[model samples]
Target: MIDHLRDMGLGVDPVCRVLDLSPSTYFARKTRPKSARRLRDEELIPLVTAMWEDSGRTYGARRITRALVRSGRQVARCTVERLMRELGIEGVIRGQRRRTTIPEPAAPRPPGLVNRRFSAERPNQLWLADLTYIRTWTGRVYVAFVLDAYSRRIVG
Candidate 1:
């Protein structure tokens, strides 16, 4: 940015001052050599890209790190992850999603037995039954109950 401004007749010193940057610091940054980590990253970019492509793009960071280590390459999983993100590549997640309800459109439908009404003249006149499940530490616990509509009480 400073270079662009300098090219457009603005002095580096004045631009640095307006941007709250010291001119000397800006000049030093421009002259400074690339850091060791940056150079290493540049070297590793191609290797990571090749490894990712070799896996048919189905290997994520963890798997990629393992493959690199098996091939005698000392690289961290996080590094591979970062490189993969920079390369804009990711693994394909293979699995079927669990579906609890799969309604059949062609099947005959059951009538609304209660007709959306819950009132009753007596205690046992109207009862509503419902079934549901709850996930617990062990597994899913299915629960079924009957409620007396007139008294608004759980009968079972």
Candidate 2:
């Protein structure tokens, strides 16, 4: 439409005015081209994209920048972040985890024979036994271990 208007001897400003477009908008479209800086950014985008993928998408901007620097490519963190944003890439966010230990009131409790002081004067003088659970496809499996505190050996 702009080309047709221009060929008909109507200047871009007058055509844009007739079409209800601002002068700045018309001139912006006319002057916009593949600038050297824009071309460089476009070229660097693929490099950044490959690096982001090669890291299994786990690295944030800082790590990606470091990886680029390690590979003899000096890149800034903000640059990596901007390229990642322009490429529609994002970093993974890990979720916070909680401890799984739970106290069992119904299970039998063994007496604290050592009185919480684990030191034993001689080998075989004191032994400790504990049972724990392990998860498997079949369900939870119980494991019992007997230990000699003095020798630090698994007696059973």
Best by TM-score: 1
Q: Put down candidate 2 lDDT per residue, 1-156, tens digits, no spaces.
A: 887889989898888888899989877877899788688688778888888898898878888888889988867888889888888898887664434477889999978777898769999988988888886667668899999999888999
Q: How many angstroms is residue 73 displaced in model 2 relative to the true structure, after the best TM-score fit?
A: 1.5
Q: What is the C-alpha lDDT of each candidate?
A: 0.89, 0.83
Clashes of 2: 0
Candidate 1 local lDDT, residue 108: 100
- Report the C-alpha lDDT of model 1 over 7-43, residue by residue, as the tens digit: 9999999999999999999989999999988887898
**Model 2: pairs clashing at backbone N, Cα or C within 3 Å:** none
The regions of model 1 sitting more than 4 angstroms off are 96-156
Cα lDDT of candidate 1 equals 0.89
Question: Which ten contiguous residues of candidate 2 have the minimum total lDDT?
Answer: 93-102
All candidates' TM-scores?
0.55, 0.44
User: Against the correct fold, how does model 1 do in TM-score?
Assistant: 0.55
Candidate 1 clashes between residue pairs 3 or more apart in a chain or in different chains: none
